[model samples]
Target chain A: MSSYNWAPGFIDDGDRAQIVTSRFQYEDGHTLDRYLATGGYAGLKAALARTPTQVHEEVKAATLLGRGGAGFPAGTKWGLCPEGKWPRYLVVNGDESEPGTYKDRLLMERDPHQLIEGCLITCYAVGLSQCFLYVRGEMALAQERVAAALNEAYAAGYIGRNILGSKFSVDIVLHWGAGAYVVGEETALIESLEGNRGMPRLKPPFFPAAIGLYGKPTIVNNVETLANLPWLLTHSAAEYMAIGTPTSPGTRMIAVSGHVRRPGVFEIINGTTTFRDLLYGDEFCQGIRDDNELKAFVPGGGSAPWFLPDQLDLPFEAKLVGAAGSMLGSGAVMVMDETTDIPVAALTLARFYAHESCGKCVPCREGATWLERIMERLVDGHGTENDLDQLLEIGQTICPGPFPHAASERLGLAAVPFPFKMTTICFVGPSAYTPVHSAVTLFRSEFEARIVKRKLIPVSIGASDE
Target chain B: MTRLNDANQVLAREIIGRYPKARSATIPLLHVAQQQNGYITQEAIAHIAELVGATSAEVLGTCTFYEMFKMHPVGKYLINICTTMSCALMGAEQLVTHAEQRLGIKAGGTTPDGLFTLERVECQAACTEAPCLQANYRYRYRVNAAQLDQFLDDLAEGQLDAEIPAHGVVARVRQSIPVDRAVSVVAPDDVHEAPVWMPLSGTTA
Candidate 1:
């Protein structure tokens, strides 16, 4: 079979350093032997040779950040863990649940050891006795592969007591999450790990570092962030720093889906490429599928805001993309062509938010359902002139407004839930409104076109007057 | 009310052993229990609570939150057709309509014969392969009407048992962690059977 360019972890044009996805080049690359041949465990061995502080120093020098949606510095987060705390845990987030994002799935399936080595390095740095790898419930293949890899690592004496003849030893337990999107949140994940509903915990005393799994200090890093450790440790920190921008260092895996000629995953240097290049480059997606003109695209996953073709020139960095009115969250770009229906797309996202709401908070629970209903009515040709404005108002109430005030507010009416901002205990509430808000602003005509002419309402006493 | 077999019980113990605290193993044990019974029943809930060192109420709290863990008895094959953006763009709604027509059931209904349970789910992370559905969570992508009909035919004949087992069976590969490398397989001493399914008040955190 010809080697397909549309392969996960397949970089079109780049050096073959192969940090997170090094094993994609070989057959059965997940096996210990295959990974070892590619200099995989050398980083862990080097980390073993040095003190944990030095490992932290190297990672800090690289300025590595979390690859999960939130881009916090990973090394500093590790530093925040209180020193000499017994049973301090390291949790690697393998729960790749964001819509249109699947890079972590590939990393877990194709090269389990990369993640394993990363875990080993992290556990050593943070002085943790164990690390929990939580995989999503639906990823059966990823779970199986990771389980087998953990078994192999245990058998080889890389895990358990006195690992690799070093004083450091970290036990790994793999947990499978039943289908819940909120579990991807670190605190919620900890709750799910404790056999509770995966509801997000409040901050300012509930941070994972201060209070985490089993009521102990825990360092929770994304799979991609941890996977970068083996490479940065083996290579010099300066070398790793040179790969990407100063703000967002190192190459990131971008999963390009939806209306692309060759939809797949590719690792690109951060901030070096634009959406246009990623979408149209021959070595990349080879242009949009069916030669359809691009209408709009989701800069990140479905939860992130949308961007029109004019914004395609924005660089692929989190802060830059955020400045451009979108986010590179999860690095999954979903391209929508001219034939796409913006209202229907907005409805799909709204429905997802509504269904996934944990029903804990008020604004999220009520506002999500209201937004979904309004969008549904808009798409079904039953919307009125005020319905579109009503969706914006309700979305603002759910998300809390600072930017892009609802049309009703512009019309000088009383703002529903005025001066609201991040009221919910978690980000899920704000997320429920993001897509609807973005769609209404970018494609107002689409929402308005679905509205039918307003009819007069009849009063009970004056019914015969018609 | 069926309980896990002796072999599955042993497997469950090993999984429980992996966790430092036994209560953390609740989800894994639930998966095993669901694999034993087509869905989690009272008996399986009690047994899982016993294994994971938690209350039956606590167990139910966890189980009810996740969508994948079935609370009621479902058909043998769980047909989940993803109707999200990617699939919807490729006409997944039509596929859902067609599947519902062919099965003579709605999106969330199970057939009269107890063979197929149809569900119109969100994305299954196979967006690249548009218009995809899963037969018992095993993906079948780029599916048209003809392929769906063929799949239904195969299901009717009971020909896909080797590839796709009946509902609730988690994985074909049995979980057997070797004895020596297994960490802390000993169950906690204070473990007891759940008294009842009473959801306690206060401190849900």
Candidate 2:
């Protein structure tokens, strides 16, 4: 269990509140002894002392937002399970597959007891009888660490039947998911847990809290979202609210990669911290790599639209970033310096979504792959002028909206808001269109330059033609 | 084609018991099947369907949707070099090219010696350690051409066998939960009252 030597880049400068990551700096932190020594399960003890409604209200008062892609409030999502529903199930979404996002993976590997405690408190509050932890299959170390932690906890009476001598009893099962990016979405995650293709079910009738896994009431919370519960319950909700901005009242982990001197995961004050503070601040990534100037950055994971240098002062708040034509989705910031090739950068993401399309939706399957083909030809200097327009036209078939772009300020085109219109079942279709919309809108000159320098090689049909 | 041996059959039953519905155990059983044989054999797939109460086609459908399950036999070591956006920004493509040249095989091709298979993959969630790759799903981060060469040499010489297992072995640690400690589970229709753990009507904690 102590074999994992943590890679460098987990910052613990003591400047900000390290709620979830406080134990990450210590060796053997994943072990039960280290976890118990570091004030683990104290939250569950404190929570068990209160009524279920009281524990639920305290979490609501703290205003803990989901750290997964969507920033929905955790308390409100818990309250949606309908009061009289018996035998509710809690499903923890540990399948952290979003590209550029690795924060949840760290949480699961470093301090699994904290997450296990969080789940205990949550199941007690939500009146859930059973819990399922769904982790990605590719994360071998994380799975082993969590499994060992669970074995230790069960033997210690932290899990299974009347935990800690309380009337509340719950069972926690760890399930591993095979490789599929679509399962990161909650509904798709539920489908995958049922041993089906990880395709997103339609909303309204299929809302998880009402009718979910095995046709019973279920609540799916992110790994990081539940990981915060232990810390929130150990301290008062007001104490938790005292830190960070009023709206986003807690610290959040942002995984910064790409051309940065210090590319790693750092816990920063939510909403108050700006992109400039993150990229250039001494406590965070110390500016672009090799003294190079920042060209463009994806404010979120690969699904987000690209942001230019002009938007560097924007804060980490969801509303602020959403208003400015992108989102802090998944808290994965990817920076590109002056040496970046814009078309190729866009194609890298385009190719990913194309390869990952579940093929359940035709627009995402066909349209994303179609866009990748054009991007490949364009990058290879074999594209025509019509290919650029074709990329947008095909993208429009998937998303079908005036795309939210940062260039709308300069171009004078009216900017559409967040929750872009989509023709497909889930956001994967629109996710594929984001790179095309961003690259074509902001870096038109780059695409045009590549296409204008198109090279046409003569074809030799037979041996005689050579 | 091969079937699960006596020990794997016992393991398969334990995996199936973890779920309330036998069908929910489909994916895990597929993993066990792959672990038994490098690639999921036709016989294993049929056997899994019988264990999970699913048809063979249904089992195949679920297996094909995931990227990790390989239908055909691969090399002894599976090296996945990531070239996504973050990794691509850090010259991950160049690392892939170097690997291709040294291995003398293209992205999806296996080496002639049947020892190595290289694939240019998407993000491995190790972006900060850009230009990363996974040998049989165990991560090797911040890799350069020299590091890759040394890694390949070590892998070929069995120097890193303890760290990185064969391609089909996901992890050395297997999860086993005894039945008595498990939650009281039944069919969805059988759950009528408030859960046994929840305090009845006006009783306070």
Candidate 3:
């Protein structure tokens, strides 16, 4: 099989038998034996050797960021917990349900031992005795694989009391979430884990590090993020950091789907590869299968804003994407070719966000539904000038605005800041606005043509929607 | 026959205990019921409703919301086709047609031999390998009409008798065939009885 240079040292060996990990090279089926062979439980063993403070410092030095949406540094979050807190829980957010995102599913299903190893390391780092792997409910097979791996760890003395004859002890629990897009959010995940409707809670007082699952100190890390812990512990942080960009180190699993010749998940070093490299440089994604021109791309799943083809040169890093007014949200790159109608595609995504909105926030609930309805009307050729304005208005409403002037004034405070200023405030509402704004700005002519012609002019699927 | 095996009862109680209000356990209870019994019969749903203190309609509403919960009887092997945009674009229709033709049944219909049940579903997030299907919860991605044929053949001939490979994006046949033939066997007690169809409210059709 042909191998691609995904990064400086990492290569897509295309080996079906070997499991992909930073330190270990285990054959596919012998996960338990091979994992043990490669000093897999060494991190847990090392963590068990030290105090929780030492473990926390080691992780903090590694600077591992959560591989889920919002790449917050994992160690920093863990260090923020109050001392002497009992029952600190580590939640493995395995709810990999993001559209165009399938990397976590592959990791959880293929090399579950790696994830369990990482979870154990994390539990020891935070002085937590119990950890929960909160997988999406639909992933029955993945859940079973994880459960089997956990059982294997328990049987092999990698988990449970005095793991590896050390003083540390931890137990892993598997919790499946009712399928919902909102449940992927940290607060919403906590709610769902608590067996409540998966609605996101307001921040400030309820941050997961302070008060989380069962109202105790909790840290929720993504599957892929936790999967990196064992490797980080086994190898020096500098060795791992040598692979990727300074800001975003290590390999990121990029899931490329939609209108590609070969669509699958591949792990690429954070800044070494570009969109074109993933999409066009290989026989796998042989550049728009049907000779269609590329229109636009969702750099990160359906939630992230659309990026014009020109922006493909931008580094595939979260910080860089955020600088470009888009997010590397979940690393779900959805490529849309020319044949796709921008209005129709936008309407479809809008409809999804609207349907999945938990109805807890007024702006997101009402605004997203209105945007979907209006965009649907516009796409179907029933758009009026008023409808276009209404669509824009709804998009603005969903974009977190400052509190109303009257409310701010009544509170005797300075002018209220825009909702976008609060980094952790509401990512969903702003995320919902990205595609809408992009569709309007980049495809103004298309929208205008649809309105004037009152019909869709089909373009090549690979042609630019703009 | 086992009067709710220990595992099933434990699963039921465990799911119910997760919720603060016992009434919130209706949906998961119905799922457990369906998993225990091949399909959620009216009696099973009623029993769940009584257990969770929910009306039948309320329980039914929860059941109908998720596509996984089966309201009616399915064949021994359930084949769920992906009908979402990504799969549709990759000729999921052809795969569905091929399945129907090979199985001699429609998309939502079961085989006359009561061996296979095919249904259309929304996106399975395996769009990278578009045109995928889930047979008994194991994903079969990058599927075409011919691959489906090979899979059906392997399944029919009982050649597939290993644990399904848990990961990757390749097109391969996966099987978790039950070890005990007695446990895996789906015996038809009688054939003369009318084909029982549950209300479509809880089903994708």
Candidate 4:
């Protein structure tokens, strides 16, 4: 929507990945006419001609997964809604508030029509008549572009009232979330869409696909995941599946930020690209900025644990990264060079989780705030060994794992049951401790170096008060 | 001035009709109300409550949850500086420290003259353009101390006024749905009131 003179993006790296960002390769692709000229809504036309089940089967065959943090299969998610539910809704998760993730922002602003067309395909396939695009509030330019494109679509009969001579009449409402990271969660997004405070609802009773958006069956997909629809529809599922691994097929957008020579979103074939290639290879980041040695990198977004330089040669796939005790979450590679202060970095990421924690669950709400406080003290050089112990203790209490004490020693603490099942309602609980825990574990010396024990004023041990 | 004016009320109603439930319009109406006044006021919240069929406390609760919906007045130009990981790695902290020195106020403080307020934000989603800042929510990429000075000078002399608006007015290009495509006009009794900003049909281009 605005003029720009950024670098020639990572799309130039053709051999590494099929360039899914071809629409964005040109500046004019954001407009409806330009997008149509580039064969954009042709997918929707082809999709509408087929039966809804056929449309569902094609998507299922391709196995395109959600680009949001969950990485759930987009096709399987569509099948979750039970049939015969009238007024079924489609929600486009454009709330890309992940710390190092900016791929959706680029997609929304650079080529919005592809995303809208993707939404139309999903709406038709799912037999849903209404869609709500919950865009982040700060994305003003993206909203403007999408709004202008919607006006064009409305005029061309692409959106609203019987589409392309078909009986299906679909409408999409562009809604805005003020600014809450928790709303990225489907149920919290539903809560935000309902004109209430965005809070993550407890699952099982509130699994969004089965019952969501005012207790109706809803399908939620990320912007980037939906943007891939036109390409998949135009090409055969076999062609799409040939791009990446058998499991995590197709190209994925990776927002490579932090200490990179050319920091921007780079699309890569899943399970092929490694963290080292992303941060150092010519096609991607072109090496860390100032030619410094890469010390550590967040393989995913802020929630991901830091990957040390020695361990970064592993492929960028969910299974491999998960095997390495991290995740390919949101595919945001945030790098930090040798000069970075480990304690400060931990505190910064910890603060984000704490600030965004919606105060809904005790583990996330209390745990995040508590971790942020301890991390701050560590960064400020007033940390004690006890503070480190306290952080681990609190983190476990929020989402307890193996009992820290002996079975015999745990006799009295049985009342303090822990969720050990990943803590709170949302991932915010474990995410809050991700950076803090990782830093304490991987860089113990760094934490110990920052310690400057504060002397407490001597006090009589509870004198006669008891 | 705090209440949605005669014209904006129609726009509010049109937005309300877009959703099955009228209460869903609360967020958009809050934006329109904020634009009318610099920030949301008690009267505007009350007006929005009545329009959306929600309680004042409920509206306030929703408003408070979002960081963008300002409850108090802000400076004419809000300078949101990104100090997150990506930007920090590229020297955003130094820029912030330099900005504090230049402005004679720390981040989140408005100048005494109230022209600009500098805020250290998490990220503005412009990580590629490290050390970026948003003036009145418009992007300023790859900024340094020199750029900050020039921006302030331009702002002080009303040079950047054409590009950047006052705090509350979010978008310079208004959203004007065509008359024929206006969802509000579908029902006469339900939402007959026409929005003032709706451009005549076929003229949006």
Question: iRMS values in order, in angstroms?
Answer: 10.2, 2.5, 17.6, 9.6
**DockQ, ranked from best to worst:** 2, 4, 1, 3
The 10 consecutive residues of candidate 2 chain A with the worst lDDT sum are: A1-10
Q: Is candidate 1 or candidate 2 better by lDDT?
A: 2
TM-score of 3: 0.76
List the candidates' TM-scores in order.
Answer: 0.91, 0.95, 0.76, 0.91
Per-residue lDDT of A35-153 in model 1, one digit per residue for the tens?
87889689999988876767888998898978888778888887776543444678888877777787887788778889999999888766666688898888777777888888888
lDDT of each: 0.77, 0.86, 0.65, 0.78
Q: How many clashing pairs in candidate 2?
A: 0
Using DockQ as the measure, which candidate wins?
2
Tens digit per residue, CA lDDT, model 3, A403-440: 21101122233322222432234566665555666677
Candidate 3 lDDT over residue span B81-123, tens digit each: 8754466556776788888888888888988877788887655
What pairs collide in candidate 1?
Answer: none
Query: Which parts of model 3 are misplaced by more than 4 Å?
Result: A1-30, A283-286, A290-292, A400-433, A452-466, B1-7, B10-31, B39-67, B70-122, B145-205
lDDT per residue (tens digit) for residues B63-174 in model 4: 9999888888888888888877778777888999998999899998989998878888876777777778888678888888899899889998998777777887765443
Candidate 4: global Cα-lDDT?
0.78
Model 4, residue A65: distance off in Å is 0.6
Listed models, DockQ each:
0.25, 0.55, 0.09, 0.28
RMSD of each: 6.6, 3.9, 13.3, 7.2
Q: How many steric overlaps are in each model, in order?
A: 0, 0, 11, 0
